[model samples]
Target: MLRKITSLLLVGLLLVGLLAGCGAKPEEPQTEEPAKEEALKIAMVTDVGGVNDKSFNQSAWEGLQKAENELGVKPGYQESKQEADYSSNLELLTDAGNDLVWGIGFLMGSQVEQAAKDYPEQKFAIIDNYYENPSENLLGITFKEQEASFLVGYIAGKMTKTNKVGFIGGMDFAVIHRFDYGFKAGVKHANPDAEILSQYAGAFDKPAIGRSIAESMYAKDADIIFHAAGDTGNGMIEVAKEKGKYAIGVDKDQNPDAPENVITSAVKRVDNAIYNVAKDLKEGNFKGGTNITYGLAEGGVDIAPSSDKLVPKEILDEVAKLKEQIIAGEIKVPANKEEFEAMK
Candidate 1:
């Protein structure tokens, strides 16, 4: 019985030792599951000019794509077929829980305002329009297109052989008015004796109208023409190419399309503006209920570089000096007729 009890005790001690050893074997380090990536959803609604217009809409779209690639965000877009689709398209993006919704042009200002009011919690941005009573969730982006146009106009004025320049506008709205006033201002700045002839197509997408206007301007002895009429500007460039006159492009560098005729383009850098706003939102530094003005100082507007072949080095250097002066508060570019006249 004693031997049996001793054996039982020994067996019990061995079992305890085995159990403790098993417990001490350090739990196999657990592999933690990776954190899931947060999805950032952004969207843009195009103006009536559509996405492929190679102008405003295209710039905005390019910005959205850039955000998607860099920030790992998902972006969706809706092409506006007509004026009536603006509200619906904005609502569609918001309803889908988009982090930001962008309205591409001034034509969608009313739609954006109404939609912003309806969805006060949603973040909204609109280009080329300033809201009077903007919501806290809304941002109005306005560009100093006049400043850029002025630079291009100076180029046209200097390059014109006939001492006559022409301007083709998309519409008679404030935005278009600013472009016209700026171009004329620059022309006068470069050549005080230069004559400027201006016309409006009354439509942003009518190429035929733009072509007809260009023909009329060319016939009137204007050797250089600048167009601010979205795709309609393409028509103007075409006319310049065929007639071997000079043309200034807008929104993007269109010098490549008509390298021989296109002297320069008023680049608005809409893509950079849109991208900056999106980046701010992504970084949690979004500022709202304000009007953001991007101009020559902020790299928001300028003449394109593709015109190196057409513009003389001395002219480009002069433009650079003017750009610096504008940035240093030594010179101011006007946006309206009164300011333009005052500057003149």
Candidate 2:
């Protein structure tokens, strides 16, 4: 009887061990990690004026920054120290596999075109320039700078205390010519008796040259000066402050640079253009191989709202009417010296 009882206990222990083994969980199979989406890269190559030109180049960078802040894009830029640096800088950005690269000024048009051809798979854009037959990957961005320049010129014509106002330009290129002629037209329209003084610094980076030009203009009894010179215009503003005269700024609102001296600014909305293009790219609706011109009607260019700080309300009211006329195509502003001469 004792042997039979021990055998029964052993059988019962074996049954309990089998039941525990059956209740154990099986091992789980492994899974690969999910892939993350890649970020879109955008970049620009600045002209010889450099990135902080406080005018054209600065405005373009501001636009790119806006896109970066609002569109989640990886934005970058290469500042060209000299004209020769444009191609290399653009090449560097292109080789980095950026989703889009921009050439900041018309001065880089040929270089940008060459880069676009060399890197057919990459996309490119240029500001203030257009090609006759561009590659499918290149987009041209232009603004009606003349429209905005005319408005400010009108103000200078009406507000000049000495009946003489001055216009200073950079490089004397077709682009700068637009600013020069438009201002002349506006001045002629507003004050027929006003004498307009014009000069070209032949360089956009030399402030000393700009200062000397401004001094000469002021000494000749010119009461107001409008400059389309990039960083060089900053010198004209400084001279205006010292002489207690007024200066009309360009590209961006420069009143903050010298509140007492800057009566107004001709604002070209390069920032808006940059933001729009980036948004279109993000939405996969980008239209390459085409030139788009932004004008007063498109809100691409206009006088700074801060004009009210120094510009009389009556003058502002007149400018507003002229703006509408420009937008409506009633007032044709000249884009070149030939057209201006014909209009006169």
Candidate 3:
């Protein structure tokens, strides 16, 4: 009997050991949360104006910064020193494995077209110009700058005590042409007799030329000047402040830079467009091979309201009413020289 009991005890101990080994959970299956997705990488190739022109390039950089802050993405940029640098800069970004690359101005349109073809798998976004034939990986963003410029021009026409307004452009491109024509149209719309003098600096980054051109306009009795030049616009604003005349800004709300002279700014919201494209790309909803246009209706263009000190309350109220009309389709703003001529 003692032998049998000892054997039973040994058998029970063996059974308990087996159960414990079997129920040990197999080390929790060494499970992991399925490695997190890697962050997206984006790059921007700035136009000849560089990054700090306080215009389109600056706005585009702001958008890239926004993406870095909100999307957990990495951002990089390369500045193009000249037209020849466009292709090489794009190649550098592509070689760096950038998931998306942006070309920041109309001057980059041709380079973007070629780059898009060279890298069919990589995505590209171009501002201010849309390719007639785009690849599946390319997105073209165009703005109705004239719509915003017209509003600012109307304000200039109403505010000018000298009955003379001037337009200073960075270059003689379609983008600047729209600004010039739109300003003239707005002047005419507000006061049929208002005279608008226009000139182009021939270069977007030359502040000296901008200042010289503005001085000429001011000499001719232009009390208000609208500048679409990049850094050149800064020079124009500087002259306006020194001359104690009103200056209209472009691209962003530049009133803070020259508060005493900047009555208002024709805001292009370039950063907003950049942010939208980046956001869409991150969400895997990027739509390419198409041109996208942003207008007052889409909140893509407008006049900055931060210059209340320079723009009187009456003018602001009137501008607000016109903004509503434009959005409601009750008013159609001219966008080009032809449309402006028709309005005249």
Candidate 4:
């Protein structure tokens, strides 16, 4: 009886051990996954021209898109319907925790600066404007508009069948002055006898006014018109297409806008500038309280590609030569009427 009880107890113990073995396997070492880094957030506040102005605002937005696509950034923008929306749009982006906020035009200079001060920890950038005493967190970017404008003006000077061209500006600010005087200089250099008709629409978004101004110029025998207006310039290009004249687009390659009517564009690489800034921030090399200027030498501005069907090869060759001279500092393009008069 004693042997039987001991054998039963041993059997029971073995069964319990087996049950414990079958119940659950020992847990394997857990390897936790590394946490993913959050994407960099960058955004911009467009001027009154909005994001699809097909000019300045459009170029900047394209840059942001590129940063998003190439660098894996979170890109965004708020279009301003009018000047009044600048502050609100910028503040909204800032509050949303954008790593960087860009103001697309000079008109928002004061607002950008104020926002930079109001949010001292936030980073800010503005285009086409700079301050004498910028906040430590603010960056100002300007472009050498005259250099690119001069190249296209040369094209118009050579291509004009009527020996007369026109210039339409959104405003008479210093920025527009660069386009105005540079074009005048190029036309003067290319065709001394060529006459230029100039006008200002007083607004960047008034396409109707731009159309009317273009009509007056074209009616006055101006065969080619170059406009530095924003959306307003789109109207001028439309008129060129209808009237069988030529137009030079600005800020971006506008050939797609009017095809044959748009001879070429004076491209100010706002896209490239914006992309560079974003890249700098991504690389931890971005700095504020500094002003950055881009010109032909810095690849900030250039003439858009010329179609052999529109601009002749010789004209392009001449323009290329001028570009080299400008880069080499052999030629000093004037930025305004005062400098234009002083240029030798």
**lDDT digits (tens) for residues 196-245 of candidate 4:** 99999999998999899999999999999999999998999999989988
Considering TM-score, which of the candidate structures 2 and 4 is the better prediction for this target? Answer: 4
Compose the digit string of candidate 1's lDDT tens values, residues 70-133. Answer: 8877888998888889999999999989999999999899999888899999999999999887
lDDT by residue for model 3 (195-292), tens: 88988888888888989999999999999999999988888999988988889999999999888888899999999998898899989989899999
| Ten-residue region with minimum lDDT total, candidate 3 | 25-34
Models 1 onward score TM values of: 0.91, 0.93, 0.92, 0.94
lDDT of 2 by residue, 1-344 (tens): 99999999999999999998899888889898899767789999998888898898999999999998998888999999899999999999988989999999989999999999999999999999978888889999998889999999999999999999999999878889889999999999999999999999988888888899999999999999999999888899999999899999999999999998899998999889888999999899777888989999999999998999999999999999999999888999999988998988
Model 4 scores a C-alpha lDDT of 0.92
Tell me the deviation in Å of residue 273 in model 2. 1.1
Go through the candidates in order and give the clash count of each.
0, 0, 0, 0
Full-model lDDT, candidate 1: 0.89
Predictions ranked by TM-score, top down? 4, 2, 3, 1
TM-score for model 2? 0.93
**lDDT (0 to 1) per candidate:** 0.89, 0.92, 0.90, 0.92
State each model's C-alpha RMSD to the native. 2.7, 2.8, 3.1, 2.0
Off by over 4 Å in 4: 1-15, 18-24
Best by TM-score: 4
User: What lDDT, from 0 to 1, does candidate 2 have?
Assistant: 0.92
